[model samples]
Target: MTLTHNRKPDESKTAVLAVNVGKPQALPGQKREVMSGIVKHPVSGPVFLSFTGMTGDAQADLEHHGGPDKAVCVYDYSRYAALEELMNRKLDWGACGENLTVEGCREDEVRIGDVYELGEATVQVSQPRQPCFKLGARYDYKELPVYFQDSGHTGFYFRVLQEGEVAPSAVFRRISTDPASLTILDANRIMHQGKQDSMGMRTLLAIPTLSDSWKQTLLKRLTKLESEQQG
Candidate 1:
């Protein structure tokens, strides 16, 4: 079967519903008290957006979390209800530890490398957020890490190209569209599903705007697959 992608343009001029920030705090884990920034609170005023991330935000695990490429984690505002229903628990904005909680910017609509003018700052889609055990730890649901990975409801990240003060109600403008059109949904599917399709993997690898972590991970997998195929 041939792979075909159906993408929808995010035409709605939906302004960001909330801007959230969190500093590292003690969180309850299954076996230990973990330091994490996953539990964020929505901000009512403008927050400075820099290359590092929102001014007040900080991640406990720097190696795995914060960096220039994965500066701002963004989550879909519409996903909360479905997740609450599935998890049988209520969740709020910044539940995912994302800096920007937005509407209409679903994984299928936002493409890698796509540049957008968000408030006074300019940002670009770097990669899909790869949820890990930290997420499950945050909510006290151990399976959430796996569910987030498989469900593709995992949000994406943004690299701030230009720094400025961003407000809660700022709108997103697609200032530059990536010609690759590689949606974050597709990227998640390819990575999590581990499909044996070289073409699909290559498509993601071709994207210069892809986060370095993702590129390295995908490349390593592809290399292993190639080695096995040759042997």
Candidate 2:
């Protein structure tokens, strides 16, 4: 499919509000230390981004997180208000392990293959972040991940297309959008909400820009469902 580019109005433009980076650290009550990177602070200057991830950022479990496909995690700052209401507390900027806290781009509006120009770096929306137990561990709220997933506010990840420096308040412009129009919200519903629309699953599987890990996961589910029907 041909990529479509549309320049949005200045009033509607999205920008980075904060750039956060973290290193591995040991947490209390956990047998193994987790590099959750959830306790990020805003950077005063530009930070380098790469295929693996931003400089100084590390993942505790590489098997399920951090790779060329899942390079940078982005969360919309707007969602925090709703989350705070849901959890009945104030949350910090990087409370969700996001590398970039952005404004204007929400999960439902951002497509799976949407490409954005973030400062000197170029990144593509890879897939909806799959919340895990670590989120609950970090926040001490065992149902936080479940609440995040149910809310459809599970922030998405970015695959670095062109490595460069990124900073806070940098303009984030969408350069292209995938024609399929399968958004991160839709994908999240299929994975978490148990929405079994076979045709939708096929469409998601056909998206070349989607993360292979997600594709494999959907394929396995689809295959199992088909097998059960045949039996």
Top candidate, metric TM-score: 1
RMSD of each: 6.0, 6.8
Q: How would you encode candidate 1's per-residue C-alpha lDDT over 142-210 as one tens digit per residue? A: 898788788888999999999999998886777888655688889999998956877789989998889
Cα lDDT over the full model 1: 0.84
TM-score of each: 0.92, 0.90
What are the runs in model 2 whose C-alpha is more than 4 Å off?
Answer: 1-11, 29-35
- Candidate 1: TM-score? 0.92
Residue 109 miss distance in model 2 (angstroms): 0.5
Clashing pairs in 2: none
Q: In model 1, what lDDT does residue 125 have?
A: 92
| Predicted structure 1: clash tally | 0
Q: Model 2 over residues 58-121: C-alpha lDDT tens digits?
A: 8777899889999999988877766666666766667678998877788888999999999899
**Which candidate tops lDDT?**
1
Model 1 residue 102 distance off true place after TM-score fit, in angstroms: 0.3
